[model samples]
Target: MTMQDSTDLPRDTSRVDSLEDKSLLLVDDDQPFLNRLGRAMERRGFEVRTASSVGEGLAEVRRAAPAFAVVDLRLEDGTGLDVVQALHGAREDARAVMLTGYGNITTAVAAVKLGAVDYLAKPADADDVEAALLARPDALPEPPENPMSADRVRWEHIQRVYELCGRNVSETARRLNMHRRTLQRILAKRSPR
Candidate 1:
């Protein structure tokens, strides 16, 4: 089509709208993940702000409630749900998403009740976050392009428990109901690809 015809043909100007107020708050205790996600979101047209703890996230919310948020379930100081709640309290129109490495039914339900638009497991990519933030109320999100493999999920679970138990092999093994030696062996191996 000619340039003038192309201009007349309806153009998707979603990215152009990024110049508008698309402030986003991201809270996670994981330093690397937080930084990476922040940069990715910025590239996707969001004015990204980040915090590493519940306290920081609350402070950011108090300063100004963002249009969107992605918060971790557990923080060093408190639960990320606190941030989500505060954001909703500040701005009723804010859309929030909860993130967790340790996902469970109760917490997911709680996130929804607290006004979160969606709940996502840890290791979620930038695309997933963007889709959730901008999704229409009546639309369902598309599935992830690359979901975690079963082995990877198992590995992540073991790793989370191991960290939660303060890296005490015996305790993690006991909690997981696996033999200490087996737990040790799994820990020793590299995470599945």
Candidate 2:
């Protein structure tokens, strides 16, 4: 089913009051990640409502009329691209931030064309997300000149897959079409503090 089909679900209203007059809707399939990120946003003076699916997130947006939204590109049931469209439909002034572990030029460009204010790769710290949200209209950070580098593109690919799979080596390897051992070896070579 399409992401649009998923936005018809009910939502929670408990934390709506705490969102500092600036409402935010956060959508991700990872529940734990959502909890942590939602709390961080709330602490930063945003009223945060979270959903694990695109459908529920959209419902929250309709209910809360948030000023901003942070959406994951890939949800468990649908993609966040549809969420971007829905948010824009709800509030023309609303800013949407696309968060994903699948970082690519095509997707980034599509996000912008689809109305996202910014696109961020996964594992992005809360501060980074906040900074992007607070950036002025003309001050949005530019995307990397060239996101793909020959020498390190493979490493980046692995990292993105790993993050998208929630750090599960097996899932990452499967998605990358590589053997688990190879993925582990690559990860092992990285410097550790």
Candidate 3:
């Protein structure tokens, strides 16, 4: 991997030719994460389809089954399991991974049983997802080269809660047991490292 500018960007490369029909579906209610991951998947040679909710995901599945999928565990309209079930129904070979910030054994088992080949926690990058989607039982998840620091973890948790509260500072503060002013100050700053 050669540096392309200071960012250490990799050269555009693919294991398969561009003509390979590698359709992938991604469903997550978080718009920013969804878009970023979708673009990353595209760069990795996938024909990406994105949706933000179960209904939208299912609709896309009906339109065409994807060979690979990444689904969020929670969505505004319904659970990601719904999307996984729909995909499994439409395509026997669909390789799907379920992602969640709140992971538990029950849900993990349920997700795998429902059709997801793998389950990942939130903050999983594109590579982790791609590996899961293209599952090889012998392969293992590569640890993040740049793991989030404590401050970054706090910032991300607050942001997730705030988004859950519809971005209402007071509501988020109340839920997190933080002063409104402090929460606002934190939100106003550039996220911590």
lDDT of 3 by residue, 44-163 (tens): 889999999999999999999998899999999989999999999999888899999875445777898988888898899998887677655445545766776888878878887897
Candidate 1 has a TM-score of 0.67
Candidate 3: regions farther than 4 A off? 1-19, 137-193
lDDT of 1 by residue, 1-193 (tens): 6457665787543322343579999999999999999999989888989999999999999998999999999999999989999999999989999999876555777899999999988789998788778777666556766777899879878887897799999999999999999999999998775
Candidate 2 vs. truth: CA RMSD?
14.5
Q: Which stretches of candidate 2 lie over 4 Å from their true place?
A: 1-21, 140-193
Q: Candidate 2, residues 33-148: lDDT per residue as tens digits?
A: 89999999889888788888988987887786678889999998888998888888888878889999867655777788888888898877788787766666665365664555
Supply the global lDDT for candidate 3: 0.86
- Evaluated at residue 132, the lDDT of candidate 1 is 78
What's the lDDT for all of these models? Answer: 0.87, 0.79, 0.86
The local distance difference test score of model 1 is 0.87
Give the TM-score (vs. native) of candidate 3: 0.63
What C-alpha RMSD separates each model from the true structure?
Answer: 6.1, 14.5, 10.0
lDDT of 1 at 145: 68
